[model samples]
Target: MKGMASYSSSHGRLAMAGNLALFCLILELASVGLAHADELRVGYYSSSCPSVEDVVRNTVTNAVARDPGMPAALIRLHFHDCFVRGCDASVLLDSTPGNPAEKDSPTNNPSLNGFDVIDEAKSTLESQCPQVVSCADIVAFAARESVRIAGGFYYPVPAGRRDGLVSKESEVNQNLPMAFFNVKQLEDNFARKGFSLEDMVTLSGAHTIGDSHCSAFSNRLYNFKNTTNASDPSMDQTYVSDLKSKCPAPGSGQDPTVSLDPVTPRTLDNQYYVNVKSHRGLLSSDQALMNRADTARMVLANINSGSMWLHKFADAMVRMGKIEVLTGTQGQIRKSCRIIN
Candidate 1:
């Protein structure tokens, strides 16, 4: 009888253990499901029922089609915001009227003035989609639209990001890649954000669609005269003459600039690679990719073949959008899309 009791006690303990393990498994699944539900909530507000991404893309494309000149400014704004804090839509705020140093101040970037675009897009999206979508998703979708309008292809954009309340002009100054960056500086900046050298080259294909303000690279065009130290032999004489006509001096407060793709200035095509191959790239940083042995092969491959460039560009954009994404309370829903608070 004692032996029977012992066996029964052991069986009861084992049954309890199995029940506990099953309960734990159910709890784990619930936690995961709750996390995913939170992500979806963070993506869209409860009041509205439309996809903000759709609204943003449509609005931006329409805006650009109405004013083709807006694509360059839009691209600049997108890059400035993304490079600063992972594209949180902080850069789209118009927080300060007079203080140009404020991160959310449109005055800081008089040339781009992204708030105007954001305002128009928001007003339209609100009218169409109502209160259903978040501004953070709008910004991401707008970035992709801006890039596409500038003559690039689309990549998968993972949605559900929230806007950040803070914008830092200083951060923009610190993070933006200069026209004079060597291959190493470019590689390091990209590497910090989990991108490889190949990704750097592929993403730089954005140069194919926009124009650089001569002010941004006067040092390369007018100041770099010494043949041994600062010469850029790749510049086209006609293009340089045109630039000089617009911007006569290095500090002349001029906007003289060259197109990344002189042939197809408005199309997002492989022309940027072709320009690099011919040594007509506008920025030293762009030309450097062609000069470096490490990245030169990739540059040549893209320039020599169209399909290869498109495939890599698409892949790199996907990789870029995935960098350090903010999901699960990493950020907040901005009542105002522009300001972090």
Candidate 2:
């Protein structure tokens, strides 16, 4: 009987040991999860710039105040990066040791490293935040800032994005929607990434602040017959004539320049819609929205009133942040925001 009691006592002690071990394992897991959550929150908050957008807005407002001739180059840079890959800073990194002149010179057509603005902004943020913010979030913040600087609305930006570790020129060529795409082509491209027709129109509102080179959309202006001219009848004659005067001959790829938004050419207002309403859209894709009965009405409604358009634009941007993003172990934390292997 004593022997039996001894065995039972030993079993009891073993069971108690197992429970304690299980409890300790659970506690350790909880601690790790809490740490991870904290890290994610840090990443999210660092990306937002509560005061940065206002600073950018003031810069653009001051530029216009001083000189209306201030080029929309900065606005163009912001739009180009955001549209291609959901505003990842991959567009700004000069990972390769190429010529610095080639990097900054807008005249260098084949290779344009226009990420100087991105670098400057990142440097500024790093000085203040230091390894807390992600470049992806910074791009979004900068876009709104650029708009505000150009006298546009201050759209709400959602944070919590990480910098991408890869930037493929080939990918940009494939993914970035061209200025010459037809309405259907543009629709398919945006839809592939889960954007609706309304989203497309509102996002294109970005044109309100940027300028495009003749080379970018010369196909539409000069070679209308060779490309999608069926929808060409919808464009504003005055605007098209202006484009023709600038582009003149096909394949010239020279001398033409067009503002995405003619009315508020340098401002980030709802004027792109106003342009479309007046049939003054610069691109076939822009006019295509109005050419269609359904999209045209929506454009008219949104343009006439600013509140709805702003809300939709903000929502679409938030949805964009949730795309097939690379985070955690999927992508590396790129030391340099611009270049990636």
Error of 2 at 296 (Å): 1.1
Prediction 1 global C-alpha lDDT: 0.66
Could you give candidate 2's per-residue lDDT for residues 1-341 as a string of tens digits?
Answer: 99999999999999999999999998896665344323332224534454454443454445446555342454445444555554455566553544232123333243332345545555665665566556665555655555445644555665555666544454554555566676778788888666787788878776765666666556555546666432256666677777777665654545556666766676656788888788877766776777678788888888777877766765665566545444455454444566543
Please name the candidate that would achieve the greatest TM-score relative to the true structure.
Answer: 1
Which candidate comes out best when scored by lDDT? 1
Report residue 209 deviation for candidate 1 (angstroms).
Answer: 1.0
TM-score of 2: 0.69
Estimate, for each residue in 1-341, the C-alpha lDDT of model 1 and write its tens digit.
Answer: 99999999999999999999999998896676445334543234334545566667777878887877566666666666666676566666655654333343332455554566677667766676654345656665676777676655666565666566666565665666667888999999888666788888888887877666667655555647654334345777666665566655654555655566678887767788777777777788988887788798888888788767777776665455444445556667555565545
Q: Judged by lDDT against the true structure, how good is candidate 2?
A: 0.59
lDDT of each: 0.66, 0.59
